[model samples]
Target: MTMPEQITPTGDMTVQTENLCAIFGGCAKCPGHAKAIDCGLVHLNPDALVFCIHGCHQLRVREKA
Candidate 1:
């Protein structure tokens, strides 16, 4: 069996207003890199530099990778 993908999340309605967000280096440039939405979104945390919006979704596994 293969390992599972980690869960993640995101933010920003108008786009890259969150200059601190690293989601796609910035929400503005972020494509729908969503493997499952729950694990696709990225954000920043007060305790952690990087954070996920959700924590119950698994990312899809690419056959090529």
Candidate 2:
């Protein structure tokens, strides 16, 4: 996957200002798919540093390897 160019830090996970966003709860397109579509997100936490303007349910965390 292509990472966003402008990523803003939110605690640990970086949010993409361009079009990336957290797909909370789940994606309606298929079963449990975390995707970035149409420059929007679903059921995202309001407090999340990197999130879509729409908002989603399931929260994803990133760990450096």
| Highest lDDT against the true fold, candidate | 2
lDDT of each: 0.33, 0.36
Name the lDDT of candidate 1.
Answer: 0.33
lDDT of 1 by residue, 1-65 (tens): 12224323345321222222244444454433333332333333222232323222236778995
- By summed lDDT, the worst window of 10 consecutive residues in model 1 runs over 12-21
Candidate 2 local lDDT, 1-65, one digit each (tens): 33443334444442333223232322343233223333333324323334344334346688889
- Weakest 10 consecutive residues of candidate 2 by summed lDDT: 17-26
Error of 2 at 39 (Å): 15
TM-score of each: 0.20, 0.19
Q: How many clashing pairs in candidate 2?
A: 11
Estimate the TM-score for candidate 2.
Answer: 0.19
